[model samples]
Target: MPLHPFLSKTKLYKFLKTICKPFHVVFKYTEFVAFIDENRNKGKINDYYNKSTAYKNRFQLHDKLLEELKNKPIFYYEFGVAGGDMIKKWSLTNKVETSRFVGFDSFEGLPESWENKKEGHFDQKGNFPDINDSRVSFVKGWFQDSVYKALLDSEFNEQCVYHLDADLFSSTLFVLFQIFPKLKTNDILIFDEFSSRDHEFEAFEIFKKCTNNKWQFEFIGAVNNYRQVAFMLK
Candidate 1:
């Protein structure tokens, strides 16, 4: 075996990792800032709104999105349904009997530490959401364990509205990769934490690149300082 490969499997590698750990956050953040600058004009978005007074109410942007979607039947997939608020809103907003809403989350919280939140920060004690609507349902467990299976069970070619709010890079990217192929023209993608540079922002940029120009999107709307954004496939 090669000496370097052998050493990499040893405890010294762990020791080296500890030494390099502190720089990881700083370097990734610097790269993120640079990424934001380079891609400032690259996306199709032109307008942005901050919503300073009611920064948390993203329903405003959702209402505007209704214009683009024209209150049509929605195949809405929400990746992170923490308190079940958004699902309820969508269920009530698009009452087209054909519209279906699916929410996915571990209900056990963040899969790993991101930003200032601990790994189990969003945990709901494994208690699933209670939504009264028949059109709404949820997939409980980590994205890796639940997403593919859910897609396999459901069939859809309708324009999908993917609300990626998983918070962590891994969760967000997994949903994007799985759903990107199933998306149809005019399908909408919404990012709840798009400004989390090292997490959601990074995954989205990577996802776009991986598609290799196979996809084109019109940046449609934004809320809360681009923290939440919508895009429509062309």
Candidate 2:
């Protein structure tokens, strides 16, 4: 998935805000916009603000969780890993080969109903780049309709960080139901688009019902104006 221009701008602005917050807010705002354009021109940014920020937050939480679960290994599984950017970065930076990074995507575009994804959503066509690392792999097809079949056809091990970023409500709901029974204590589930009013929120409500109030989630942080990531401890 190529980066959306609007999303990139938003991410650059956010990073700037965090670093420049304490030093004269009004002046910092002006500087932030200028820095964003400079960075854009230098081509130092990737297109996925939502996923990148979510990955960063998960790692932060993971560090805390790691201290709590010291002996246990770390692993991450994500639904809808567009362009495989987060997986690549985390694998390289963290250097955790034992901690598997699994990504699932249709590798095509969003389902027809997802056409209304307002804040820079699109149908990504074709497969992700060849990831040489054995720790990461991409599962192709819609998780909502094909989850069972996919699992039966393949395999996914236990994961510490489970990211749900699929744009469609039904697809996200399917993942919740499919993965719910497998969740264990201290497992973290991150919902990248939870701030969206429609699909993501609706899916969360359904997840609450399906979970029978057993699983509880809370917002960890906001990615930007268009997206926020939520964390569920299981």
Candidate 3:
């Protein structure tokens, strides 16, 4: 039922928005849980889910990606490369010199507070990680930068593995919308903080709703209780 005309525009609703602000996160979380329940059963469910830490599950996903690609040259783009441990692992896992690995990070730290992590929580003093890989490079700036613009104008002729670890709803949504158009069949997409209901998970659900592109995916299984998950564009 629709709200009554008077209540619809009442200041009481505005007041409630201020007083009930904290529950907003809880509501978002609940919505995300429903999303997971709906989509988790799709495609394949690898046996490793919910049995290990997220870090280990992440490498497991990476190894699976390489195995599927047969270690071929590909494009790997990682958003939120704070200390770059995961990106570094990806570089070494695929030794193809022609494979390009690009990381996007402000390096200053988190642009905004996320849960218990305050702004600048992951501050690196603006230094890039020392990864000695010829095919690897860094885009040192916000996710919405020249690199994003370049991506908008670029083409991905080879297989692309996009790692969405931005850990913020705004950042994740920005990257998803930007790349949603360029995604090709069989391209891989990974989410490091996939279970963060108010962040990555919420963003993913919203992105699916807001886009008219009719993007379809192959669920490549989630690990660590859906904290780390992988999907394939279809």
Best by TM-score: 3
Q: Give the winner by lDDT: 1 or 3.
A: 3
For lDDT, the strongest prediction is: 3
Q: Which residue pairs clash in candidate 3?
A: none
> Which of 2 and 3 is the better model by TM-score?
3
| Pairwise lDDT winner, candidates 2 and 3 | 3
- Sorting all predicted structures by TM-score, with the top scorer first, yields 3, 1, 2
List runs of model 3 lying over 4 Å from the truth. 1-11, 18-27, 39-54, 152-155
Task: Put the candidates in lDDT order, highest first.
Answer: 3, 1, 2
Each candidate's lDDT (Cα)? 0.80, 0.61, 0.81
Residue ranges of candidate 1 with Cα displaced over 4 Å? 1-54, 68-70
TM-score of each: 0.80, 0.62, 0.85
Off by over 4 Å in 2: 1-72, 113-124, 149-159
Across 1-234, the per-residue lDDT of candidate 3 in tens digits comes to: 677777556767788778798889778878867757766665354543354464665666666666766478788888999999888988887888688888889999999999899999899999999998878888888877745676864548889999998899999999998888788898898998888887998888888889864778678877666777788887
- Give Cα distance to truth, residue 82, candidate 3, Å: 0.9
Identify the superior model by TM-score, candidate 1 or candidate 3.
Answer: 3
Candidate 2 lDDT, tens digit per residue, 89-118?
555554554667777888775664564555
